[model samples]
Target chain A: MKKTHYSELWCSSPRFWGGLTFLAFIILLGLGATYYMEHQGHWVTGMSNQVVWGLPHVFAIFMIVAASGALNVASIGSVFGGPMYKPLGRFSALLAIGLLAGGLMVLVLDLGRPDRLVVAMTTFNLKSIFTWNILLYTGFFVIVGLYIWTMIDRKVNKYYQVTGYLAFFWRLVLTTGTGSIFGFLVAREAYDAAILAPMFIIMSFSFGLAFFIITLISAYWWAGRTLGELRLAKLKHLLGVFVGAVLYFSMVYHLTNLYITQHHGVERFILLDGGVYSLMFWLGHVLIGSIIPLFLIYSPAFASSRFAIGAASVLVLMGGFLQLYVIVIGGQAFPMNMFPGKEVVTSEFLDGVVASYIPTTAEGLLGIAGIAVAMTMVAVGSRMLKVLPENLEDPKDLEHA
Target chain B: MSNKDDRPDMKRREFIGKTVLAAGAASVAPGVLLTVAKAGGESRGVSSDVRYGLLIDTNKCADDCTACVDACNRENGIDLVERPKGQSDDDWNAQRPQWIRKVQLKDKQTGEITNLPMMCQHCEFPPCVDVCPTGASFKRADGIVMVDRHTCIGCRYCMMACPYKARSFIHQNVAQQLVNAPRGKGCVESCNLCVHRIDAGDMTTACQEACEKDGHQAIVFGDLKDPDSKLAKLLKTKSSRQIRADLELNTGVRYTNV
Candidate 1:
């Protein structure tokens, strides 16, 4: 591999300031929304006793999942010894940390008592999956921070491979914990399957890769530098494979649910009768998220086009959000079957009927703020540190074959 | 047959003698009677030796009566929030906190209708207790499931884990709350079997009192461990079933003729 030079992103351009300003505005708006919701209580939002978790959870979980996925580039380079991917490793680590921070912020800020974060950190429940995730998230930052340090400093470079391996393992556990948050829920009919854990891992892979690719292309374009077709093609293909894997797991999950007589109602809700859920699954997740991206990545005519690849990446992200919406919100929308054979003729609560949820403006802003936070972190980190590779155009470095 | 008739007469004479003696003692020393009553009633702290339970006779429950629900709200101070101006009544109803509710159900196959009050089943191995991230949702040693509000982070995982949909999250700040209940915003709660009343040595729950006072006598509350108790004797004589018994929750509440 040719000697690679790393440099900090120049911040003099009007575009950089404009982008940063825009992100700051969004973040401020989100904070305002958070304040209003906290002061007035959750009544101001669409969340209720039935749909307990709402829009904020959807965004927070997505960013957290994608954060683990973003480190894949670094793992491929350091753990798997891929020379072509090595140049992208530093940026990958940075983005992983940045994205997680953004996601955690949203999660914490959306809490009923954000002030009680200290209590959450101090108290520990060994049995609860949420508690384990708290540890996993913090461990990820420390381990990945060391891995990035090793990459940047020549003196500590010898530990890069070992650190990268540790980070990789921690990320797997983190994503597993996230998935199990739903999978371990035995009370809900839509969850309780073991497949959800691995399915989330695969989802992280696709989402992370797509996010990394989009950020990579955007950063390079802004800098007026050429990101070689070879690296782009490699990332595009890898993303395609991950997206395909996600589709396979989703199919298996639904098929397994279909096979169970007990799960027939839930399966029917997701596949047929559930109006919004069904639309999101079929249209947003299947077609736009998986099939369309797969087509764009594999098609000979569009495979090499930067525009097509970028568009596919964006679609994958949209699909990722839609998938979570179905899993989290749709799962809650279906009323719990307290009485299996008897129909609830009348009740104070909405029993034996679909619960309705409409996201308020505060919820929308809070969710959008998560995205802005992640992008702002990436922008600032790139500008302040020598993260991005100067160029990936070297022929010798492209010797993946 | 003549001996059995003589035995009944003798037993009646003995019961009347004891009743007269008890009435004379009560009239003679009112203060001592009060002490005796207190001693027989209040127990110090909850003990695992006794499990509190409820028996509902669905057949006796009135179809249009919501006495139990009303009593629960009054006891727990579950007041109605004025519907937010722009929101529909249905939306507000879905968000309101309800500790107990009257559910009317009709059998799909038999076309038979039943009226019953539903609340937390207080499962022996509650799913909410298992899934709570902070150990806030827990079962008391006496088998009453409850939430420790101070520890609850408002994650609402307990709501998801309750199969009966018995849990409710306080979505808005509460200005008027029962001193015993102490409800607040962003905390998940459910029926605690009137824990405060139980602690105060009241054997009957608010719902149980209301039901009996309304002349229904449909709800019975007692210690499940005592074989001589009314609940135990009723269960022995009557056919009773647990809701969603397939889950093997071993619920503290049981129903007859459901």
Candidate 2:
């Protein structure tokens, strides 16, 4: 086989410029919104003492989780020795870094005291899961950066396997850390289960693959290149398995919660009577995010159709956001049962009532900004760096493994 | 002769008065001596040996009374802020910082009503402290759970971790604040058990003082470790219980007659 070559995308086309401009505008608007929130204080946002984290966290967590999952393509090539996936590794690593950066930005900006981020970095509570996450997140960038270097530089080509292995392990740990952020919260009934760690790992796989497939198709379409049917078919199958796994985990999570009498209230709130939360869980997460995607990827006719698969991917991404909203916001909405058998007749801090949250314009902008930042990074990175393969078409001389 | 006698008497009386006044002033000139008598001599750090706590008797707490809550607000300078123009009353109620609140509870089956002031329990294993990424939410040596405002990034993780819903995040810029309890926007705070007053050697918190002042005396504040202290003695004799004993946080505050 002839030596493979990589090239930077020529982003001179009007479409490319238009896309970049749109993302930039959204990012700028998001920055303006963040400024307004910081100046006016959190009172301007829908978040309150009751519902502390809002829309920004949902966007931030989605990006971060997907970022880790995006690296699976590279891991399969380098760690597992799949020749077909080798060419896609560079783009995978790049997207991973970009997505993580975008997510971290939103998270940092949404802090009650964004100014004290330096303090957060400097003063570490070693016991806190968040502290560990900070380390894991930063370490991921450095390790992945080196991994990219190993892939690109011929002198360091031999080290590719080592770096790839390291990146793969780090990604797993990073996603686990993210999952444990919710899982380890013993105070919240919805979060205390240890299964959340593995559940997030599975979620990352589905969401990340969906995001990767969408980005790959869009980028190739714009570059006027073709991604082969075989490659798309492989990714679609993997995504289907992941979606099924997520459904299984979710079912187990609910079943476990049901088995415990203490957790019945929280389980009931999410699955039954809790209005918006229940709908988001059932319709958004279960139906659109998991079931539909599973059907699109597995059904013989739909599996071969690119449009159906693409639609499935987009739905999965949307479902990821809805799932996070249910977890983060819905968990807080349910009033904590401090007194088991007694009813709180009245209290100053709105005890015994479901906390309400309506995302403000500022919050919505901030969330969109995270997505824009990630997309902008990918667009600019692809343009400037030799990240994308010339073509994904298999050579006639090379035999299928 | 009469004038001479009066002048001598006045001079003698002035000399004796000056000597007594000077001696009195010398005895307590630095005021450290006065504190030494009250605090058992040399000024020292808050000791871990003494876990400051409150023993609340819900049976004696009046349903209509809000003296403890009122006093806590006044003492902490948690004054009521006018709701933002478009903000609903419910939103404002949730947003407003409440270090202490009066709760009225009724048993589901028995219909037994009880009134009590609920605030930060100051748990020994405080979830807020454990969850704080920056150690901003901390438990003092004396077991008073408080936030280090300077380090708190206002992530509200502490609020999420708190089981009792005791923590409050300051949502807006605080215009009116007491010098003692310096609150601000974007930081999580809760009942610090009146840390400032505790450090100043005040035996009772503002709530306890107000409750006693109202002649109810439903609350008793003292060291939990000292066997002779009222709180410890009461715990030994009375059927007092921690709010959520199942968590086994060993909260500083205990309640009797629920």
- The lDDT leader among the candidates is 2
Q: What are the runs in model 2 whose C-alpha is more than 4 Å off?
A: A395-399, B1-44, B80-82
Q: Supply the TM-score for candidate 2.
A: 0.92
- After superposition, the stretches of candidate 1 with alpha carbons farther than 4 Å from their true spots are B1-44, B80-85
Residues A240-268, model 2: lDDT tens digits:
99999998999999999999998999999
- For each candidate in turn, give its C-alpha RMSD to the true structure in angstroms: 16.7, 13.8
lDDT of 2 by residue, B1-258 (tens): 145575887777888899999998988776766676757633566778989899999998997999998999899988744455676787788888889998999999999998989999999999889889999999878898999898999999888888898988887777777789888788888998888888887888999999999999999999999999988999999999998888889999999998
> Global lDDT for candidate 2?
0.90
DockQ of 1: 0.45
